[model samples]
Structure formats: structure tokens, C-alpha cells
Target: MSSQAEHPKTSSSPVQNSIPASSCPQKRTFSACDLNCKTIENKIRKKIKHSWKRILKVCKEKDISNVGEIPVSDFLDIAGKFNLDLSEGESNQITAKYDSKKNGTFAYYDFLQSCVLFLKPKETSLMKRVIIQKPQKPLSPGPQTTSFFSATLRIQPKILHCWRPMERTFKSHDETRSGLLNVSDFKQVLHDYNIDLAEEDLFNILEYYDKNLTSKISYYDFLQAFIQ
Candidate 1:
């Protein structure tokens, strides 16, 4: 992992139901929002990393019913300790956006998102510039080798688990429904879904699927690259 204290590199995602579109920065302000997203995400990650153990302890002390999750009240208390200005309205919004289980509590990553909601931006319109095209070439199944078999066995289940969600997630973010995600859109999708990945990681993975160097990746190639 990179130094938590250093600059972060995640992208932005869609506005959740609780946050109105008007609350998101308009397209005119996207460039600045883009830069802020990286810096803010980095800071949030660093703070969370430093205070995670403490947060967990707080959860236990508060007697949260679900381990690794904390209610809004406890979250606000800990957020205050971290010097975050969490308001009741914002806390409710965060819970609505990230409490995936509808449990009125937040998992660690989701909590991180809530803490940095100001950094989340509207989906950048830049992705619209890249035209969606079919995959120029199919991914190779790989050479038949003993190591391949072992690796496949080890990773197959994990891939299956992520595949369906990955597809669904990609579609959700691809508002154009164009069966592809440009680089910006893909990064934003990763950010929206709270996938822990670096900018370099996204680029390298995209390289495998972006055969034409078009900066666009199709659904088939997305599945291939995402699973890796």
C-alpha cells in the first residue's frame, strides 16, 4: 500500500438518493472537483487508517449489535474525535447512502465515504467524448500449465463473486447504457462503489482491455479486466 499520509488517487461517483443533483457540483466545476477528489480521498483514507483501531474499540464500547459496524450516533462521536464536522442531516444522508444492509449502521469503508462526502462529485461528462466500441480482441485463456490450473482454482470463486456485482455496478454508472466505460467513468465507478484501488492499478488493468488505446473499454473486456 502507498503511504497513507501521501496524496490519494480515487475518483468520484454518482450522487446518492439523499443528496440532490443540485447539491453536486455542476459540470462547469468538474475539473476542480476532480483534483479535490484525489486529495480529499487520500486524507480521509489516512485519517481512517490512523483511527481505525480506535473506531473499532469505540464500536465495541458502544455495544453496536453488528461487529465492524457503528450506528450514526457512535459515528458522529468518533467523527468529532477525528475533527470531522458531521451534522445530523449529513449523518442521516451518509447512513442512507452507505449503510448497504439497511441496518442503520455503517461498515468501515462506508463510514470513510460518509466522512468525505464533500469530495464526492457528480459523474464527469468527459467520459461521453469516448465512443464505445466492441473489444478489438478477446482475452487469451492462457497457456495450459499446472500453475494456471492451481491459480484458476484459487481465484475462480472470488472472480464469480465479483463478476455479477462488477457488471451491475458498471451498468449503474454507465448512464448512457452504452455497454462501455471510458477511463474517467470507470474510475468514478470504482470510487462510487468504494473499491480500494489506486490510479496506477486502474490504468494497468485498463491497459489490458483497452486494446485500441481508445480510452474506452467494452462490457466484455470490462469483465475480463475487472476480475483481474
Candidate 2:
């Protein structure tokens, strides 16, 4: 049998052993496109912060539990309530951006934080000092020692002359025709009618009228109390 001559196994060539520069993964560099995207994102955030209070109020009205989230439909309704004027596509984009859980609900607190810079407790020492210097009285009345009707008597004369017009104004603000107005709207009606009362007294009236803590007072029932 003829023995064939065996050659030593050749080692991998440099071209084969070394990875090509093109084939190796490269570190991503921040480009102008990325900068433009960041600019647009910041603009959206600024706009959101500008309307933060109204958005929060509407969200609170709908999310009574204060879970910091609401159904997508309610979230959209909030836009209409505050006249955000979001187009269908814009609304969809917002929902997608804030619905982090993918559960069909928008997390409002997440959205709020993305735009609004809330002061931390440690950062609000100045505000705390101001509050401490002049403590605010609770808006809700404590112990029902006095009758509500008696309380109304104080503001009666002021509202008495313009009572009918005041009723009309209150009804007009009842945009939902629910015959009820939220606390802010009720206060606004009183302001428009030029019926002023001390803050404590105004809150006392609200507490009496909003006994259920529903944040809504029936205008008809409320106005009748003033007359009586």
C-alpha cells in the first residue's frame, strides 16, 4: 500500500481570523436627526406643561380614585373638555406615548412628569415656609353647629337683587345640562354676579351644598337656599 505524504494542517489566514471592520458592530453616533427629534419632543412637553392644571383637573374629575390613569376614551374626552384640539392622529400618538402599560388606559402622572417639573418636598422649603407662616383654614366646615340656611342669610342680600340673573348664569355654566356645577364654576358664578363672601364662608356654603362630596352642587337647589 502506497502511503500518501500528509501535510501539516494550515492555520486560518489573517483575513479569515480577523473580523472585517465593516462586519464589526459600530457604536451609534448621535446625529442631527436625533437632535431634531429631541427638539420636537421638548416642544410637546412645554405645551403639555402650559395646560397642566386644566388637564389635571379634568383628569381628577374623571379618575375619582386618583389612580393616575383613566380609560383611553376618557383621556380623549379630557382633550375635548380643555379644547386641546388634538386631531385623530395626534390623539392616537398621545395615547400610545402615555399608555405605558399597554392596558388601554393613559397614565396621567407619567404624562405629567414627562412635561411638568413638580417640586420635590426637599426642594419646596420656601413654599413650606410660606404655608407655615400663614396657615390656611380647611375649606370643608367642621362640626355642623350652625344651620346652612343661617349661613346663606349672610350673603342673601348681596345675591337677592340679582337672583334671577344669577340663576341664568349658573344654568348656562351647566354645560352638561346636569343642573349641577362644579365648585370652581359655582365660585365663578358668584364672582360674575358680584356677590362676594369671605373665603371661609364661601367654602362653608360649598360644603353645605356639596354634602355628598361629589364636587358638584345643584344650582336650582343652591339658589333656592339663598332665597329661603
Candidate 3:
């Protein structure tokens, strides 16, 4: 049996930082530039380390906060809780990562959150190394075309519990103006990872609960399964 009282699991894929197009230009890129892709690369690596450590703390304690998205204050709170004395502006890179949440490396944050909320300890090895398509097709000319990254992390079945709701409430107007994710979508995600849970598993979970139980699955239900 697992050592912890809870069986929740989480895993996240790795990511390579993107060079801000405005930041890295051919004519302006000399030897020293703060926003240089190389500089950003180093900053990204450090940020990943810092972010991973903060996230790891929560996973170890089995605390599910931010609904999966780890915020800046939460990062600091976790660091403080563990007595991890990081310097001021220490999380600047991470903050930058989140700031770029809309455009830059946003996929990383999304992918990482899935990892944190759904993976188990035994599955971590699956993400240790992965191949990412380098953005060789440069948008501009310069020394900025040689870097792009990706990695995979597997979530063990032992650490996860997910559910699905019967009906999906969508905004119907825009992708941005969205509603809960349906079970089928969540199942498709699992299918991509080749993680299979028999229909019996779903039925068994719902057999007991009267309110939380549902005849179908929704993104919200899937999330509910984890926190419960």
C-alpha cells in the first residue's frame, strides 16, 4: 500500500522558455542583453527549479490549493511554510513565467498543473526526458533560433481519483467565455496518455454518493474527484 493516507497523484511535463519576439531582435541583440534568449533560458531553468520545489512541497503534504494553479503568493507561502529562505526577487523569473501565462510558455503551466493534480509518485520517471520540436522555423533572423524544449512526466494510477458529471454547462458564445469541461474531454486526455480506467471504476465511485455522484462526466467532476 502507499505510505500516505491519500492516494492522489500529480505529474507535469517540462517546457522550454520562449524568446520574447520583441525582446530578441537581430540588430539589437549584441553580446549583453538582459532579455536575451540565452539569459531567459538560464532564468527559465532556475525558475523551473524554484517552481518545482514550491510545488513539490504541496504534493508531499497533499495540499490541493489554487485549484491546481500555483500563484505567486502561494509560492512564497509554501516556501515560508517549509522555512526555505530564498532571496528577494527570487521568484521574479517564476512571476515572469506566470506573467507570460497568456502567451509565453503557457502550455508549460497548463501541462504542469495537469501533472500536479493527476500524477502519482511512481509515474514521475515518465516525464524525466521528452523530445520537443525546436522552433527552428525562426520568425526573425538572429542567434535566437536554436532553442526549444519539451519533456514528459507520467502519472501513476495509484495516485489519482477523477470523476465526471452528467451535464455540461457551456457559455456557447466564445472559447474564452467557457464553462466546465465534460467527461469526454477529460477521457480523451487520459487516452492520449494511454491511461485506462474501466467503466466499472466510474460506476463504483458513483454508487455510494447521492449528490457528488453523476451519470456522466464533466471537467469539473474530474477535478472534483481529485480534491475529494
Candidate 4:
């Protein structure tokens, strides 16, 4: 990957839910006797219900669970009500994941929810724009023999043994250097794992070796570096 082309990339779904809407209080369990706060809470509750209905309708079509699927349209409606905006994507090639088609909807909803709860609208509209430049004639990354992306990455809490046995914690592109292992880690974690990764991806994988550094990434944001 060219150093000049490498740019910091991130998944912005989860962080959007950490912040409470401007109309919502910090605490979710306040007594009703506190009428002032209760009024604000009530509004948030009602809004969630109304927004969820419109969002969930689309997810039902995909026959997937509700853990992550929520339409972006519904999320934007709620965020706008609170004068907030939650944005994601890299101006091109927007990416995200879920268990099934339904999950994709929920993931979108989750992203918007997190943003509304935590972030404020930007001074200049926190927007994601697209300027589709002309192709300038078709261009090939390089010779067809070698794929433009030479690296693959997989991240998970632990390895599963349902398909086979487990030995290590994490695996990467280097293992696929050989063509002999067809039924290897190549299929399960990389191809269908829902990582429609960029061709020239860049990011660092930081192993949690030190107990003291319990978690490096914060609730506000996350970072992933994949060099491909």
C-alpha cells in the first residue's frame, strides 16, 4: 500500500449511541416525582417508539434479528428532533455489517442512535458528501496476476471450533500465503465475515497483552488499521 494513499479509517456505528439526545437527561432511572426530568424522559421515550416503528418495518422484510438493524431514515428523524446529526461513511464506499439483511437495518439504526445520544451537530453540518469524479478512462491497479489488496485481517473475541479445531487467538493474511489450505481460515473469517474491506486498507491491530491497558479505545471512538 502506498504511504501517501493510506488514510485513517473507522467504523462509526457504535459510537453514535453513546451520547444521549440533547433533550434526554444523563440518567435513565430518575423518579417520576422529578416532574421536570420526567417530561424530558417521556418525550425521548415516545420518540423512540414512533421512530422504531418506521425503522423496524424494513428490517422485518429481511428475516433477521433486531440486535443491530434499524433504518438510517428513522435514526435521522430522531436525531433531527433533538437538533442533532450523526454521520458515517468515508465519502465513498460506505461499509457496515450485520448477521443478515435484517441485521444491516439494525446496525444502521444503532449507528444513528449512538450519534444522537452523544454528539452535537457540527458547526458546518457534519455531512458525508460524494463527488463522483470521472473515471478518466478505466484504470487497473497493477498487473492482474497479483490482487491489488495483498493483506487480509480478522478480529474476534476468540476462535470457534464448530467448523474445526482452535489453536490461536488471531489470524491474518500471512497465513494465506500458501495455496494448499483451501478449507483454512480463508473462508470463515475473511470472505463471508461481512468485511467488505477497502482494497488499500490501513490499520494496526493492537493485541491486549498488558492487563493494565484494559482497553485502549474509548466509548467515544474506535480505531482500526489494516494494511492491504
Q: Which of the numbered candidates is closest to the native, going by highest lDDT?
A: 2
On residues 1-228, what C-alpha lDDT tens digit does candidate 1 reach at each position? 111111224475211122111121335264554345444445555575456556645755775443445675666777788764545645544444445466566554334323322122222343234333334454432222222222222333344456566667777656666566667766555565455445544433444445446656565544442231
* lDDT-sorted candidate list, best first: 2, 1, 3, 4
TM-score computed on alpha carbons, candidate 3: 0.25
Residue 214, candidate 4: Cα error in Å is 20
> Where does candidate 2 stray beyond 4 Å?
1-144, 147-150
Per-residue accuracy of model 4 over 105-181 as CA lDDT, tens digit each: 32443332332221222222222231112122222111111011111112221111111121111122224322111
**Preferred candidate (TM-score higher): 1 or 4:** 1
**Could you tell me how far off, in angstroms, the CA of residue 75 lies in candidate 2 after the best superposition?**
58
lDDT of each: 0.46, 0.53, 0.33, 0.26
Better of 2 and 4 by TM-score: 2
> Against the hidden reference, what TM-scores do the models get?
0.29, 0.35, 0.25, 0.19
- Per residue, candidate 3 scores C-alpha lDDT tens digits across 1-228 of 111121112243212233233222235443443344334444444344436544454633442421223445655566566554555554444334443343332223332333333312122332233221112221121111101111112232222322221212211211332222234443445554455544433322222211233222223323322321
Task: Compare the candidates by TM-score and give the number of the best one.
Answer: 2
RMSD of 2: 30.2
